[model samples]
Target: MVGHVVRKRLYILVFAALIGLTALTTGVAFIDLGKWNTLAALAIAVSKASLVVLFFMHLRWSSGLMRMVLLAAFVWFAILVALTLSDEFTRQWTPVPSSWQAQVQQQAR
Candidate 1:
């Protein structure tokens, strides 16, 4: 039923876009983006997901309320990812030396 609803041209274009994005992701993997590698990959991934949701999932023709719900869901997901990444990025993994070792050795004497 869904396939019967969407036009052939639209499907063809979406397929082409998906293929192009796949090639792009592969190409980007070979590039040195330094700290921006994750950001660039994420951006491309989001674009591909959006296209799939809009066309393949038929959300583009869905009701306004459905679109609003999807938008809200995406916003919530972004907030969660931001919060998690902030915590991750700000964490210090270095081990700090404590004076307890010296104190323990002194006590042993």
Candidate 2:
């Protein structure tokens, strides 16, 4: 079976990109971004995944249908990630009652 022959230069470039992105991801890990830390890491991860999929998997030379399917899958993944993060961010927000005010009133009386 015949296929597209990827050039060595392209391979080297992709490898470099993967390495650099990995370094960036590692550096970002030590920094405290608070709530944005997870998002930042995920963004870097998606870029790395894209590089692997497009070059290593040869998806870049594939047909439009294949690309469209991948795009749809990415969209679904994004939706799921967004929903998960939303839940995570809201998890700390528990509803507080007026119990503290009642205690203050009793102390004053």
Candidate 3:
């Protein structure tokens, strides 16, 4: 059937996208982006994942329910990242042990 043929082509496209993504990620790792390293990697990963979800997973032609499921997943992922970063950044304000402070003070003197 034509649908089957088209689906096969889509599969090949998805495979190519995945291979390109891998190469891009490898290239990115060699670049000294400093703080942007993670951002770059995540960007490429998200792009590659989007392609997979859209084409390979057939979400592009999926029903509203499927779209909602994908949206929910993304929302949950964002929440997790936000909560983790909030905890990590706030940890900087936590008190250090007295012994550690004493050692720092001794070093200063």
Question: What are the per-residue Cα lDDT tens digits for candidate 2 across 1-109?
Answer: 7788999999999999999999999999999999999999989998999999999999999989999999999899989989999999888776777689898999999
lDDT of each residue in 1-109, candidate 3, tens digit only: 2232245777887899899999999999999999999999999998998998888777787789989988999999999999999999887575666787789899999
How many steric clashes between backbone atoms does each model show? 0, 0, 0
lDDT of 2 at 36: 96
What shift in Å separates residue 18 of candidate 2 from its native position after superposition? 0.7
In model 2, residue pairs whose N, Cα or C atoms come closer than 3 Å (at least 3 residues apart or on different chains), thus clashing, are: none
Clash pairs, model 3 backbone: none
Ranking by TM-score: 1, 3, 2
**Steric clash count of candidate 1:** 0
Instruction: Mark the regions of model 2 whose C-alpha exceeds 4 Å error after superposition.
Output: 79-109
Pairs of residues at least 3 apart in sequence or in different chains that clash in candidate 1: none
lDDT of 3 at 5: 28
Model 3: ten consecutive residues of lowest lDDT: 1-10
Give a tens-digit lDDT track for model 1, residues 55-101.
99889889899999999998999899899999999998987576889
Q: Rank by lDDT, descending?
A: 2, 1, 3
